[model samples]
Target: MKIGIGSTNLAKIEAVQRVFSENDEIISVRVPSGVSDQPFSDEETIEGAIQRAKKALETTNADLGIGLEGGVTETPYGLMLCNWGALYSKTDHSPIIAGGARILLPDEISERLRTGEELGPIMDDYCMRENIRHHEGAIGIFTNGLITRGEMFSHVVRMLKGQFIYRMNG
Candidate 1:
């Protein structure tokens, strides 16, 4: 099977690769999220993922399209990290959406986000590291390397695959 990943980000691409078979052809394309650079709510995040999946499918001849989007949302406690993934196939009219792990950001980081700063740059400054999103990401920093962004998205991909399998079998 051929799979097209919406984003060219290494973490997103790696997550999709981990879920698929070695023989499957996986390609990553730089697709638009169709939302703000920093999505501020679950609805927006999920919408962005679905949009990317659809655009990827439209652009590629792959049998399946995958999209991963990470954003932040405000809650009673604080601003929290939200990650969403979507899978689309030409044969299926609807897409399968799944959510990855969510975690509250540190108050310091949340404060910065509230000022209209994007998480990627904020994290880079806070962690004193360059392009942390391509590596461990904020999840890894919060979890002390226990869980990275790639791992979180991988779980979402696995869930999407499970849904597809069930739909086919049942």
Candidate 2:
């Protein structure tokens, strides 16, 4: 099968690639730009995914098109990030995965986040940390590399992948 992903995020692309690569039955995987980066409600997220997937399908004419949305939410314990993936195809079927990770933020930083600034940029601004993408994220700065955006996101992606399989088979 040929899969077209509606995202160019390296981590997300890699995670989806890993799944298809292992399957071997999948012939190809492609990542293309999708909807803009902005806050989206759960329903809007799914709708956006569907729209992106449909557009990708029309543009690439691939066997399958995947749209993924990455976002953060507030939980009782802390903040959680999730990657939601919607799979669309004219041939086989459709699937959706709402999986992610969680991390607690410092009250101060959480205030900043509430105002719409991300933890990464805030860390960069205050800590004078340059290009923290490879080194650390907002949470990683105070935790001394305890967790990273990439690490947490990778776990979320893996969880999404597992859900994909279950959806496809079940």
Candidate 3:
């Protein structure tokens, strides 16, 4: 099957690649999230994922499209970093949505996020490294590498794929 992923980011792409079979053709394309760069709510983040999935499917004209989005949502305790994944199937006009892990952001990061700063750049600066988002991600830094950005998103993709298979079979 031909699958298109709605991001050029290596971590997100790696997440999808880890879930799908080797026989499937994976196409990575940069697509707009159709939302704020730093989505601040669960609703916005999921919307971004769905939009990316649909846009990627259209852009690549593939049978399926996948989207992964990372954002922060405000919780009672603090701002929490959240990740979401979506799969859109052209044949059935169906979509499977799943979410991964969430970690409370430190005050320093939350404070910067509230100032309209994006997490990727903040994490990069905080880690004193470049392209952390494309690699380990904030979750990795927070978890001390226990859960990487790609791994978290890959878990979500696994859920999405499993659910999609169930739906197809039923």
Quick one: best lDDT, which candidate?
A: 3
Q: Tens digit of lDDT per residue, candidate 3, span 31-140?
A: 99999999999989999999999999999999899989999999999999998988999876867899989999999999999999999999888988999999989999
lDDT of each: 0.92, 0.56, 0.93
Model 1 C-alpha lDDT per residue in residues 1-170, reported as the tens digit of each score:
98998998888989988999999999889999999999999999999999989888887878999889999999998999999999998789799999989999999999989888999999999999998898899999999999999999999999999998887788
The full ranking of all candidates by TM-score, starting with the best, is: 3, 1, 2
Q: Write down the TM-score for model 1.
A: 0.98
Q: How do the predictions measure up, each by TM-score? A: 0.98, 0.62, 0.98
* Model 2: CA > 4 A from native: 22-54, 92-94, 118-120, 123-170
- lDDT score, candidate 3, position 26: 98
lDDT of 2 by residue, 8-47 (tens): 5455455556556654333223443344343333454556
Task: Quote the positional error of residue 17 for candidate 3 in Å.
Answer: 0.8
